[model samples]
Target: VLTTFDLDEYVHAALRAGASGFLLKDARPDELLAGIRAVAGGDAVIAPALTRRLLDEFARYGSAPTDDPRVDRLTEREREILVAIGRGWTNGEIAARLVLSESTVKTHVGRVLAKTGARDRVQAVIFAYDLGLARPSVR
Candidate 1:
């Protein structure tokens, strides 16, 4: 329901205000419906275009994962989850690949979020890629 112009400000504000998810103004009806459902189910969703913009912004900022204290605090397992996130893997995919339950994967994702100080998975992925934490092989 939010426009892309204010995405960065809104996303951060929404998080502070406890809002669940975000969508671009140009989102298709079906995509909007899916986003709502995902948020209702305790998932975060980002439009592909918006995700690209976020990555661009992250790169512009030059706050790579390795330079971040929070990212440095992550365990190896959390780093693995971060790389998977960077590869655009779903929780189910990451879980299946790692031989873990979906819930366990979610836990690791949450830990990664906390440790990386990321506003969301998209930002975490950007951080991972920017810092070279995620390799091309993973992608």
Candidate 2:
């Protein structure tokens, strides 16, 4: 997905619709190529500048989705992993913060995605936001 619109809803919808990457129209040519390669290699990407903006928008105004029966399957650890993912935390960050090994964090992340029916980490981020499980803290 490449567009001039940086609205959070579009970003969320694109990821939810299973877009492998989203880049702004103004992105550098090299960045665009890199994003294409990343997506082709089975990784997901989002425009760097939009990451924080997306998080802030979700924290401020995202609405809850309809009840998800699968959510009942998450363990407490997996729930925490979802929130960390929603805050845009990397796997290493989640491991460190949760005092778990990186492999353990990975497993928990996998469970969270499976339970939530999210196709990828980006989708899981949207799930967390929609469930009101994640929010920005005042600094």
Candidate 3:
């Protein structure tokens, strides 16, 4: 999505709505084209600088509690995996950190997505943030 709005709320909403990319309207022509192409190619894209700002916003204003029943369905291991995903860890990274095989991580991730009714990894990350299971890390 290309828009002038770059607020965290907008970004989060767009992602939850299945947007594959978010780009400011003022972005350079080449960058805009690249973002479009990336999204068309089935790759997600977010401006790096905007992502940093968005994380800072998340850190400042943490998610509120919700009564979503899906939260109760996760196994402890699945919860941990969700947190890792929220922290932006790749499957390989999560595998190494959790000392699980990549296939195991993938299985857990799929389970988490199914249980939470999330459309994809991005939605899972949002769900993690929404439940306060994950927060932006201080860097």
Per-model root-mean-square deviation over C-alphas:
4.3, 2.4, 2.8
Instruction: State the lDDT of candidate 2 residue by residue for 21-116, as single tens digits.
Output: 899999999999999998887567899998778767777788965566667788878878888998878889999998999999988988888788
**Per-residue C-alpha lDDT of model 1 across residues 39-111, encoded as one tens digit per residue:** 7775677776666555555556644445767766999888889989987799999999999999999999999
Ranking by TM-score: 2, 3, 1
TM for every model, in the order presented, reads: 0.65, 0.81, 0.78
**Model 3 alpha-carbon drift over 4 Å, by segment:** 25-43
The better candidate by lDDT, 1 or 2, is 2
Across residues 1-139, which tens digit of lDDT does each residue of candidate 3 receive?
7888768778978987887788888899999889888777645678876888767776677569677789789999998999999999998999999999999999999899899987667678778888887888777
List runs of model 1 lying over 4 Å from the truth.
Answer: 4-22, 40-42, 49-65, 135-139
lDDT, candidate 3, equals: 0.83
Off by over 4 Å in 2: 4-9, 64-67
